[model samples]
Target chain A: MDCVLGIDGGGTKTVCIVMNAEKEILGRGETGASNYQSIGINAAFKSIELAIENAVIEALKTIKSLEVQVICLGLAGVNRPRDIEVIKKIVNDLQKSHRLPIMWELEQIIQPDNKSNNIIICHDALIALVGGICRDVGIVVAAGTGAIAYGRNHQGISKRVGGWGYILGDEGSAYQIAIAGMKAAIQAYDGRGELTSLVDVFTNHLQLETIEDLIEFVYRRGMGVKDIAAFATLVDSAAVDGDGVANEIIDDALGELVKATFTVIDAIFCPHIPNPSPQTIRNDDFEIVTTGSVWKGKSNIRERFIKVINQKYPYIKVILPRFEPAYGAGLLALKQYLQKSDSKAAH
Target chain B: MDCVLGIDGGGTKTVCIVMNAEKEILGRGETGASNYQSIGINAAFKSIELAIENAVIEALKTIKSLEVQVICLGLAGVNRPRDIEVIKKIVNDLQKSHRLPIMWELEQIIQPDNKSNNIIICHDALIALVGGICRDVGIVVAAGTGAIAYGRNHQGISKRVGGWGYILGDEGSAYQIAIAGMKAAIQAYDGRGELTSLVDVFTNHLQLETIEDLIEFVYRRGMGVKDIAAFATLVDSAAVDGDGVANEIIDDALGELVKATFTVIDAIFCPHIPNPSPQTIRNDDFEIVTTGSVWKGKSNIRERFIKVINQKYPYIKVILPRFEPAYGAGLLALKQYLQKSDSKAAH
Candidate 1:
């Protein structure tokens, strides 16, 4: 069976899946973070290699032999040409040392930097777009620990807003939500802001004896941006329980996400129409997929987003992902391979 | 010579000043940070002890025998009762171990739990207020790496706003300004925000070859909040050079500071006047002092702050610090000592 390897790697973990050309997922494996920028090139390569080997081993249990065609790695923090080149070199080294039967054309392996479409290296945004919409082009609002609005037009032109991390951006992210919640609690405690349930919510949830202990709890080494982002759920729950401040926070988060999404849409999807109003730019052809933990909140955040987005861009629809990004990578590889084969057949 | 010891301890450094009852400065000393929450209690104690020892040693060169009547310590993160108790215990141990000629009256030394007015332990806000106003009562806006608006009435009731640190608050702080500059530059680079000089300014000033390199520059180990706050000077410079975005950011920051200041004033100073409009609060009796490096910017931030604040509270005068915080601590101790002597004579 001819299959391709699709790997999705980020700051925390890596997942690689084996899929046949027909888009059926055969086997999957997981490993620690494979971001070269964070874990170093060698460690990242080892993680990718380990995941690939385990995935291949898992697939072998059913298939007698498998011919691996291509590998697509959609990774985070890979935005520039230099980053792509570095990841390509790592892939070149991986094929040389690994036991997988990678059927790279002879000349391509000899000269790794040459133009070979077999290996695809790109940013996580591409995988997110393809995976979220289950197609090549659309928009995605990712509101996890960090937030970003990304969109790719059919012409392959992509635009992104936000994603500047906790300090600079993450406007609609869980991190921002959590920060706003904490700030409101602190301000209310100082007798400067309106009273909110977040004060008691954070205090009770964090198991803090007093609200002042929150300072020590946050500045301590163990609690990082992700851990802080986790507290955003409590704010969402408070909003669900009819807390005024928490509801306002959720509304603000939605407003920011919607604004960012509109920016992306205007840049890529509606460039021909000058000064397209939010109500007029009704893009029906592409779906707006909402990803990350913020959408999974107990509050009607997702429903509210859909209602507001649809009311503004009446033709557009908001959705959840049909498949994971690793599977999307496999589908993308098969797509490119088939496209190339069709062009060759026409010739 | 009848003198008192006053120490101002913070996250970066500690300062100790020795002054006589007549408010004559005799000697001064400096040491590293003495925040026990950040650096352990032992290290904080040693720093304080070293600063006090150096000051007393320097003062002994002029006076035959220095009798330290009282001691006042205004330290950061010393807010709760537990924190004050811990600092008081540290002070007690220091007097027992060192040679400061502390006149504890035989009771405070044997049973340290007793209420002896000789040692004063307080939050940094009190020292800032006393030092900034050169008296015991007023509001002081401290906008350094962190921002806080604090005010105390003559009746001794104090109120604070902000000062929640980089993650939670720091509304008008240098850190927030720097983060805003970084965000604007990144947004402009992504074509999602207005083009501004901040992009080129941050890129060239930071020595970054590409804007994307800023991610590594920021998230990499060595760049903490203070280092990030240092970049705020560039934004101020850009505003000075007529960058619209930078100017707007400055205006927004000033607005937040003014808002926090009003909150502090309303809490402590304006309790009798409910719903007093910002324009109607013409407080001529007390000064509103502004401190920290943000006031040192060439962008006329301090001047603009004064203009806006004075416009709102017509009769309220804003002024710079009349003395350093450590010196202010000495003045506070001397004032208390003289007041105590007057009360004893009345008795």
Candidate 2:
């Protein structure tokens, strides 16, 4: 029985799934973080190996024998080309070591076939785009700890906007919203900005009495991006309770999201008049898929984003993902497997 | 024979000046940074002592046997009451040690007099206000690595707006401007924002090939507030050379500064109708003093700031400081000396 493995690796956790050739889910397993940048390559290797082992073990319970044909990993922190080479080497070393039972079993089962299997590695956003729309040609607007909009046309041309992290970009993300809320609260305390209920909300949430204490909490104590991003919910709740400052912040964030989405759509679909030599995709019919925690919440940012996008780009359809990113990775691996087999048969 | 010592201590350098009863500039000296928060309290004490000793030595060149009457220090990072007590104790210890010739000479000469001399420690804005306006009753709009608008009424009541550092506030400062410029460059590179000349400006300035290199430079390489703040001049130059994005950033910064200044002015000058019980300083006439490097540059931010303030608060007069903050500290010490002598004569 032919099977493929898909892995979604992030800074906090890793998920692995097994699927048959027909794309039916066989087993799923989760483990610790596999982001090599944060947890180091060795630990990331261990986490990925553990997740694959547990997933293979779970799959074996329902099947007599399984031959793993291909693997795809959608990982965070895979930005530069150097990162791909580094992660590929780590995965190759893991395959050669054959330390885990799943790897050894797969090696024995696939030895007679003499067919070279493949391992695909890509940025997490790629899997998100595929999983969100379950296709290759659409846009994915992800707003979590950071934000980015990735779009692909039918011609295989891809474009991205605003994945510059918390410092440089991430304009419509949870981190930006939380940071704006914190700044507003501090401005209110300094009597330089409009007063908001966020002052009390943040003070109680962070267990701080005065807004001045936030100085030490943020700068001195060193809060991480995700830790700060967690406060976006409080800002959303405050906005829901009719705080004008919080509402403005949410509105600004939605505006940024709409602008970013529009930029991605224009870059991928629209061709410039003066310099039209770049083989533009020129597809008007595509979906704008939304993902990440920001979309899951009750905040009207998504509604406003859809409203603006619909008004501006009527051909673009807004949607929520049908499957998780891990499944999307599996689908990508299956697509790659079919493509490779079809090319071999054609030759 | 009586002289007053005034010290202005900052993160980068410290300045001290000596003024006699007639307010003559007897001597001036400079030394290293004395901000205790960054460079330990002991080092701060040593810097302060060295500056004072150098000033006295220079004064001795013109006059003989100078009796130091009062000392006033306007130091950076002197925020809370605890900071005041800590700095005061350091000053007292330095006085007790009398390690320098100036301290010993002044101690021996003033020992016979039973009158208690004074040492006043205050935030740098207070001295900037005094030195800028040649008096205490006015507003000081300081834009440096950070921005703050501080105002003092005739009744000794003072209030400050902004100065929450680079992250939470400092909206109109060089750091904010540079960050905004960098963000615009990245946004343009990502095709999410307007194309601007800042992309080439930052790429060449930071010795980077692409704008994406800024991610590693800012996040991985640990670029600091001052280092990033240094790029503000480049943004200014880019704006002057007709960069639309840079011009927009400058305009936004000017708008923030105008709003902050207006807030400080309203809080200090305008009395609330419902809660009028607080002792209101009913002075309609006061100068708005401008200081810091932002005012020195040719950028229209300052001109726009002045224009906006003039249009809104027509009664408030805006002017540049007449002297440096160190000379203002000397004036403050001289004022304290005269007031003490007047009370002694009355008794």
Candidate 3:
């Protein structure tokens, strides 16, 4: 039976899903971090290989025989033609190493062949957009530890805003929010800003006795981005519990996210006019997929995000992901494979 | 002759000044970085030893013989009692290793011993404050690659604001300014923000064909904080050339610096009120010495900072550093050594 594999590779983990021609998920697999930037290319690929092998092993229990004719990978840091080329080399290496349950010759989907041309490689945001809306077109607002606003129009035009990472940008990201919270706490401690309960919140959450210990904890202890980002939950909880500073911080973060979303929308969807007023730029109804852990916070960030979006574009809809990103990748691969096969049959 | 040594150790390099009881510069030396946070303790101490050796070697040319009364070291990351303990062990190690050009036994300046108790270790900010206005009192608004606002009242009460590093705070720092400039360029490129010449500025400065190359340069290729902070000069130049976006970034940066200065002033110099209004908090005429490369920008950051600060506290006079930080450290050591000697003689 014809099968397809979809993979979503990230810094923390790699998730894979196996689907049949009928779009039924046959198997699922997960493995450790596959971010080539953080982990070396070999380790990252090893995780992908292990995930694929595990997923195929599970699929074998259900189907008598399976042929993975298509595979789509949505990975982080897969920007630029050079990045795609690097991924292609790794895929070629995987095929040459013969580290698969089923034999499949991989190639770009454009060069259709029965024995080849069955792979699609793209960035993580694309899969999130596709998975969230269950389609290839629309915007995806991803605000986990890092934040990015990305979208693809019907004409296949794509645009992105704010994904500059924790240092330069990531304005609405959990990392930024957490940093703002910590800054507010420090400021309050220093008598530099408005008094806030975040001083207590950070102290208790981190099991610290005084806010001054934060310098030792934050710098001396060598806290990673993820570790810092984890504090966003505290900020959210504080905001929900009515801490004025935390609420303002969240408000500012959401505003930045909305701005990034609006920028993406204007780029790919709005009319191409230099400095066109929002009233001058007309847009059709569109569903924007909101993904990542930030949405799940108790601060009503999603509700606030939707409210603000509606204020700007009442026709636009904000939603949670309808499917996993791996599933979306699988769907994309399956559609491409079926479309090419049908076209060949017609010819 | 009773001489004193003042060493300023930082991330980039270490500077040492040898001074006499007459407050005359006997010798000067410069060496590699001694920031133990960046380089290891051994290497940092080695740098300090080399700078001190060189300075003392030059001082020998000026004097027949020298009795070193005291030495004060101002280094980065010398915070907390624990950090001081760690530095003390290293000082012991440096002394035990017998690495000095002259056999000078060291101890804390408080011990008041001839053969020992001659070293005083403090944070880099204190040296900058003393060095800038050539005093133990008054505030120092430092806006280098990183920034911090630190002040000591006449009564020796000290307070600080900002200096939270690149990720947390560093509001008015060159790193922050460069980051803001880059963010603006990216926003302008994405059509999310107003169009600015910063896009061209970054591209030209970085020798890239397009602004998108920044993504490749920033993320793909590793760029350090100092390298990014170097772009602050470009932002300053742009602001000087009348770029509205760059001007706004500079204005915001200066405003944050002013706020930090006010915060420090309020904490140390102003009356201890829970929330004293500006009118209620009258401060004595104290010069806030402005140090760091950011002040040298063509954008008139220093001028703008002065203007904003005067608007709030007219008595808060802003001035450039009157002396180098190492000289200030020497001055501090000289004063402490003289005060202790005079007290012992009186007894």
Candidate 4:
């Protein structure tokens, strides 16, 4: 049996999986952020190496004489063309040290390609979308550090919207919502704006006396968007307590999310999402997939997102991805290895 | 000669003047905040009495006034009708104590009042505007603890904008701009947003290691807006030295100031600047009066304000009010006294 490795690198941690040609899970390992820009190339290389080595060693312990063939990775910060080369070099260097028949490849697996090519270099969001829909036609919104909405149709055409970073866009992303909440809380504390418990909660969370104290934790100290996003929970609590300001902020965030989803939906319908059936959407058949930490964590935001969509497009069915993005990557790697072996034999 | 009195009550300190009916300065005295809400009514009364007594004694020591015929007071926190009654009673009691023919009257003067009637209770901003223009027709913006703008035309009509206290409005006010700078500095420090040296300067000012330390001084400790506003100077210094984020904040604040002034400008031109003459604008026809500690303080904000205004309303001249709002209160008191005397004679 051939050992295949799949990796999912995130902002804080990386998850790795090792399996064989029989599709039996062998081993799993976890490491820290392997994103080049965040941990630096040196640290990223070390982390990725450690993660793969641990997973491979564990798999070998269980399945002796396993021949490794394919190594697939879906990294957090490797979205650009330049990142591909860097990742390739890292993998090649690791291969030199280990001396195994490991082929480095990106996990760009789109569900549409599942019918033929099977595997490709893609984002975890795409994986999550595929896991949710298990089909080619759908949309996925990944809300985490920042928010992005991506959509595809039966024809395999994909489009994106509202993925702007925290500074510009990101609309309904956790970070965006947290920033808004922080702004509101500060205004309330200073008597410059409306009042809310959000300030109290935020200040207490930061262990300060005033909402102004959070300015350090939020702006000066360089808190993560995820950390800021954590404040959304406080906002939700306040909204439940009947804080008009907090409620307004949540509503505003929901509005932004709806707008983002609508953008993808419009793309799926018009220039982006093609209409397979001219007669009816029921016959047209489409699905909306959700991805990232935001969807998996809080129910309030998730419910709000659904409520917004239901109010707008009641016909659309929203689906939660069945598997983690890393699993999607693993499936892609397995299929790819199988295709290669079959083609080689045919030739 | 009949002694006339002028009183200027403020958030921090109070000033009182005993002058002759001829409008000649006699003697002055100083005390503390006369706001009953901030300082209890008892303390306010004691401060007012002590201040007046000192001024009267000083005046008598020199001129030995035949009698204090009329006394005028421009007090702070006397905006409410009930507050006016409380102040009136205080003065009436003081007048009785003297056992002299002193006609006592109360004037509600805070700031941001247009030229209309005497003894108009206004925000301190209006007083500062009068400090600059000393005219009946002009506009004034106070940019100290909080920013507020007030303007009046020849017909006694006044307009105010961006005076929504320290939170919602007060756009380019010192406190607002200072908070902006502080937030930028903190954002840079945290890694959540752009980086700037504002954190360094702020920490240095507060004698702290990180921006987090300063947060308590501003929020938990309940520091005055002036203390927070003081940091704006540091932002300016940093910006001058080429801090990108600091520069961006300064520019953004300047933009807000421009928007605020335009509100006043728009109000002025609402009726077309009342072009009675065929000529464009007469030098004496229109003027902008500025007051308040923020505007008078030596900051780059003033120059930017002038630059922005000139860019839009070039033909209009900006001037300083000849009398402080407290002095205006004095004038108002004198006017009322004369009207009473005239009515008595007619009767």
Candidate 2 chain B weakest ten by summed lDDT: B274-283
Of the two candidates 1 and 3, the one with more favorable TM-score, higher being better, is: 3
Candidates in descending lDDT order: 3, 1, 2, 4
Model 1 clash pairs are: none
Output the better candidate (1/2) by DockQ.
Answer: 2
**The TM-score obtained for chain B of candidate 1 when compared with the true chain B:** 0.92
User: Distance from true position, residue B225, model 2, in Å?
Assistant: 1.4
Clashes of each: 0, 0, 2, 39
- Which 10 residues in a row give candidate 1 chain A its minimum summed lDDT? A103-112
**TM-score, ranked from best to worst:** 3, 1, 2, 4
Q: Global CA lDDT of candidate 3, please? A: 0.84
lDDT of 2 at B28: 89
Model 3 regions more than 4 Å off: A107-117, A270-285, A311-315, B105-117, B272-285, B311-316
Among these predictions, the greatest DockQ belongs to: 3
TM-score of 1: 0.89
Q: Model 4's lDDT to the true fold?
A: 0.64
**TM-score for each of the candidates:** 0.89, 0.83, 0.93, 0.51
Tens-place lDDT digits, model 1, residues B211-300: 767887887545989999998898899999999999888888888888898888788777888876654455426888999998898988
* Cα lDDT tens digits for candidate 1, A45-152: 888988887888888888877766678899988876878888989888876865764454322322245687878887687788787788978898999999999888
